[model samples]
Target: MAPILQVDVDALRQLAIDMAHAADTIHEFDLTQPATGAAESLESSSVAAISQNVSWSLREAYRHLAALVDQMATGTESAARIFEAAERSFTGALRRIH
Candidate 1:
């Protein structure tokens, strides 16, 4: 198994807070049909439309989540790079000290 790279914990926490805040901004409403004389037929049509709309909405939501995840992943990668750089620098500095 490949060893997991260490990332800066603070960066991870910041990214999670950012993503959660962004996600919170999104508002979703129920797509229920209003009662009317033609409610029966409207219900059928609305059902089909609801299915399509929900699917589209879900797809869009998934895309947004994926983008957010990628952003977090990029931040994590940066943290990993910083950790590795700090490790190397400290190693070199220790050698110089000795």
Candidate 2:
């Protein structure tokens, strides 16, 4: 006989919700300051460019995580349904063994 599987759908959903909320809390700092030093030296320009790139990547990562979390939360209902179906089938098989 297959092992019975137990799951806490509500808890999973809540975790996903929490993750999304946490992701939302991530705020990007202002990095729009112009690089002005030694008459716009190469080092200053490179630093500014790299900082901008890093900022953009960070924001994108946060948005991605939030989106994934939201999706997981939304899919919890479907996951619960599948689990319910499996449990029902298992119960039926057990009953036939008597």
Candidate 3:
């Protein structure tokens, strides 16, 4: 006996949409300006350098995370499409046999 595969394609598609939106939000976020401003107020070159490095690191991290999320969104949408196609194919095959 084969195991039944049940999928909610609509929900999966919505989740993909949501994930895409979240990735966009994360990618658009700016962290450098505030960090620079704070560092400038401290008036120490070492502090400014450290702050810039931290800011750059954080921004890079967020960009990487956003890219990953975008990839996941693409994968999820692809999965939903595959599932929908499979369901349609199965239904058509069943109808032809009837």
Instruction: Residues 2-96, candidate 3: write the lDDT tens digits.
Output: 21248889999999999999999999999978998978987666887788889999999999999999999999999999998988888777779
Which regions of candidate 1 are displaced past 4 Å? 1-44
Q: In model 3, where do residues sit more than 4 Å from their true spots?
A: 1-4
Model 2 / residue 47 / CA error / Å: 0.7
- The 10-residue segment with the lowest total lDDT in model 1: 27-36
By TM-score, is 1 or 3 better?
3
Worst 10 residues of 2 by lDDT: 30-39
Q: Work out the TM-score per prediction.
A: 0.51, 0.48, 0.88
Worst 10 residues of 3 by lDDT: 1-10
- CA displacement after TM-score superposition, residue 72 of candidate 1 (Å): 2.4
What is the lDDT, from 0 to 100, of the residue 31 in candidate 2? 28
TM-score of 1: 0.51
Candidate that scores best on TM-score: 3
User: Each prediction's Cα lDDT score?
Assistant: 0.59, 0.61, 0.90
List of clashing residue pairs for candidate 2: none
For every model shown, the clashing-pair count is 0, 0, 0
Residues 16-89, model 2: lDDT tens digits:
56755654564333323432332245464667566667656766776676677666655765676677688879
